[model samples]
Each structure stands twice: as structure tokens, then as C-alpha cells.
Target: MLRTTEQKRKYIQATRSQNYQASLKLEGITTTAQTTQQSKAEILQKYKKYSQPES
Candidate 1:
């Protein structure tokens, strides 16, 4: 069975949000351990870039 366009959009949105949230949580833990702003920014930036939809 094939999914509709709206279904695909919803799926992508849900996945992106989940990935973003998970990454944020990971960043929090890592920051607590190391206390480095640069590293945290790098990690979160990488995650967001990787999770972004390909054009």
C-alpha cells in the first residue's frame, strides 16, 4: 500500500521532532558532564544538519 503526500509530511515532521528532541536531551547530558559550550553547539548543529531533509 502507498502512503499519501499528507501522510508522508506528517511522518517526516514527527521523525524530525523526535530526532531534535533526542539530540537536545543528549546535549544536556553531555554538557552536564563536560561543561563546554563549543562542544554542545557543535553536537547540536551536527545533529540538526544531519536530520534536515535533503534537497
Candidate 2:
């Protein structure tokens, strides 16, 4: 049986998350559910600022 496109995408996302968590664990950093709407917005804003070029 073959997986659908959405299923493949989900599998890849899960794999990436697992890999990231494992790397953090190896570094003695535990994962936490500390992300809130404000934090997400702040992160996005920081990225937006970082992605802009000098004018």
C-alpha cells in the first residue's frame, strides 16, 4: 500500500520533529510546550526583521 501525499508530508514533519527533539535531548535540553500565540508572533517578527535586507 502506498501513502497519500498528505500522509507523506505528515510523516516527514513528524520525522523532522523527532530528530530535532533527539538532538536537543542529546544536548541536555528538554522540550517543553511553552509556545504561546504571543511567542509565535514574536518569533515571526524576529524572522521578518532578520530576512529584510539593508535599504
- Best candidate (score: TM-score): 2
Candidate 1 off by > 4 Å: 29-55
Error of 1 at 28 (Å): 0.6
Candidate 1 C-alpha lDDT tens digits along 1-55: 4289988888888789677767978787332323344777789998999899998
Off by over 4 Å in 2: 33-42, 45-55
For model 2, state the Cα shift of residue 30 in Å: 1.9
Relative to the unseen true structure, what is the Cα RMSD of model 2?
6.0
lDDT of 2 at 10: 88
Worst 10 residues of 1 by lDDT: 29-38
Which lDDT tens digits does candidate 2 get at residues 1-55?
Answer: 4379988888888789788888998999987845234777788998999999999
- C-alpha lDDT of candidate 2 relative to the true structure: 0.81
lDDT of 1 at 29: 39
